[model samples]
Each structure stands twice: as structure tokens, then as C-alpha cells.
Target: MVKEPAVTLHLTRIGPSWMDPITNFLENGKLPDDEKEDKALRREAAKYAIIQGQLFKKGLSHPLLKCLHPDQTDYVLREVHEGCCGHHIGGRALVITRFSISEVVVSDNGTQFTNKKFTEFLTGLGIKQKFSSVEHPQTNGQVEAANKVVLLGLKKRLAKKKGAWADELASVL
Candidate 1:
């Protein structure tokens, strides 16, 4: 009879994960060399907990959110945004889910913004809705200027390949 040795597998992080600093501090008490970053990490690490070798964020109003490494984020994003359980949420829904609704909202006079249900929702929440003057779009000059810059960048980058502008927006920003 021949005896074979048992094999063990070891996994390592190839690229720096967003969870590295927090996980290291929570698990190994390691901190960066910079004083500012060390202080910041300490502050941020206080809200996180390591349980059963996994990191979770303690939310004030929500339940503990499991922290995932960068490599795992894509799967989670896909699952939440377009997978079987997803509802194909748009930017407004994403913002409302991730952050508290503001006291006021500024938008253009588009039909989407002027819709009855949206107006009633804002009114129910006691959120003041403000619209830029239609005659003078310069009322929202800053936002328009920023949009113009982004469009120009996309135009230059996507000179002959307009179809890929959506993929390149993050880099341009």
C-alpha cells in the first residue's frame, strides 16, 4: 500500500483590495506609515468587525453589511444590478438606497421630473423640489458646464467609436 501526502491550497490577494487596510488593522493591528492615514484608518476601522474571519460594517440604521474584496465586488454588483434578484434599478434608486434623501432636490423641467407620482412622492417626504428657469438654462450653468466638459472628453476619446462612451465614462471622470 502507498500513502500519499495531503495537499493544502493557499490563496493570496493578487492586487490591493479595498478591504486590505481595514482587515489588516482588525486582524493583525497593522497600520500605514503616514500619520494622517493611520489616524483615518483607525477611525474607519472602529466601525468594522471581524467575525469568523469575515469583515462586516456596522451600519447605524441598517444591518451588518458583509465587506467583500475588490475581486468579489463585480459578482455582487452584477447580482444586485442585473442578476436574477435585480430589478434593473436606475441612478435615482441607487442614490436613494445608498444615501439618505436630501431636504431639497434640484432638477430640470423635464417630463420625468415633472411627473405626478414623483412630485407627490417628494411632497409626501416634505422635500422641496426646485427647477431651473427654462428661459435661462444658465440658472443651472455649473451643472451644464460640467456636463459639457464630460461630453467633450467622451467625444475626443470616442472619436470614431461612439458606442464605447458608456464604458469609458469612469476613466474620463
Candidate 2:
């Protein structure tokens, strides 16, 4: 009998599975000031423990931004590049982003990335850029899937405190 080749899969846990404790602490019914303070401290300590344990692990993690402004997009890209590629910049990775106006400019002739500055930044880092088709998300399915996980985690963590998503992003990621 012929043996089949082994398949290897890599998985990264971006956040801790301490949602119940966090939710309980966040949603603890109107408690006394002292009790609430104690709970808050405990929750923070728990979060810190989780974060410390997972620091510098290999993963594609990004913070939740309130908007997709060009500056914000650029910051996210820089963070990803620094965290993932480190000193080895050029041609290390092909970045695929959605066809947002801030990311890519659409023209009758042909579509191109937004501007020289952003292009030069990527070139300096030796990274290649690719844009997903305007209407076809499947072109970046892997990234979209990872994004879905991150969004879902953010949603779960934020719960009723939707506006606090940005604040809890680090913990969630």
C-alpha cells in the first residue's frame, strides 16, 4: 500500500477565549462602587495575562479602525508589514487589499493604486500590491475570511458597547 503525503496546517489564535469572564465583568449588574472597581481590576488583569502570553506570536493581526481613511489604511499596512516582514521588506509578500478609492484609483483606461507616495512606500519595502476586483470579493477570499474572524471577534467583544470596539481591539486581536 502507498502512503499518502502528510498535510500540514498552521493556525493562530489571535485572542483569548476568556469571553465569558470578560462579558460577565463588563455586564455585571449595577454593583457597588468598590465591587465594580474590584471586578474591573480583575478583568484588566486577566486581559493583561492573556496579552502577555500571546505577545509576538506569528499571526496576521490588525486593529479595528473607526474609518478607512488613507492615513488609517497606510498605518494598518505599515503595522502589518513591520510585524510580519520585519527587516526583510522587498518582495517578501504580495499584499491584496479591497478596491477602495483610498487604496486603488479606478479610471476608464485602467485601474491603478491611489498615488505615488503609497506606491513608493510599498516599493521601498519591496512589497507587491494587488487589488481585489471591484465586485468580486472572492479574489481575496483568504484575507476576507481572516477579516471576518477579526470582525466577528470585535463584534462579540464590543457587544452593546459598539463604540468601544476600537478600545477593545487590542484585546480582541
Best by lDDT: 1
lDDT of each: 0.74, 0.44
Query: What is residue 50's positional error in candidate 1, in angstroms?
Result: 1.1
lDDT of 2 by residue, 1-173 (tens): 74752322234432444343433444553333587776775655443222322211122364421222232345456655675445653552534332222343222112223456545544555666665565755545655665567558756656656454344343433
TM-score of model 1 vs. true structure: 0.41
Give the per-residue lDDT digits (tens) of candidate 1, residues 97-166: 8877569877667665577766866687799998877787676676466546755875666665545433
Q: Which candidate number would show the highest TM-score if scored against the true structure?
A: 1
Clashes of each: 0, 2
lDDT, candidate 1, residue 25?
97
Give the runs in model 1 whose Cα sits over 4 Å from its true position: 1-14, 86-173
For model 1 the local lDDT of residue 16 reads: 86
CA RMSD per model (angstroms) = 14.2, 22.1
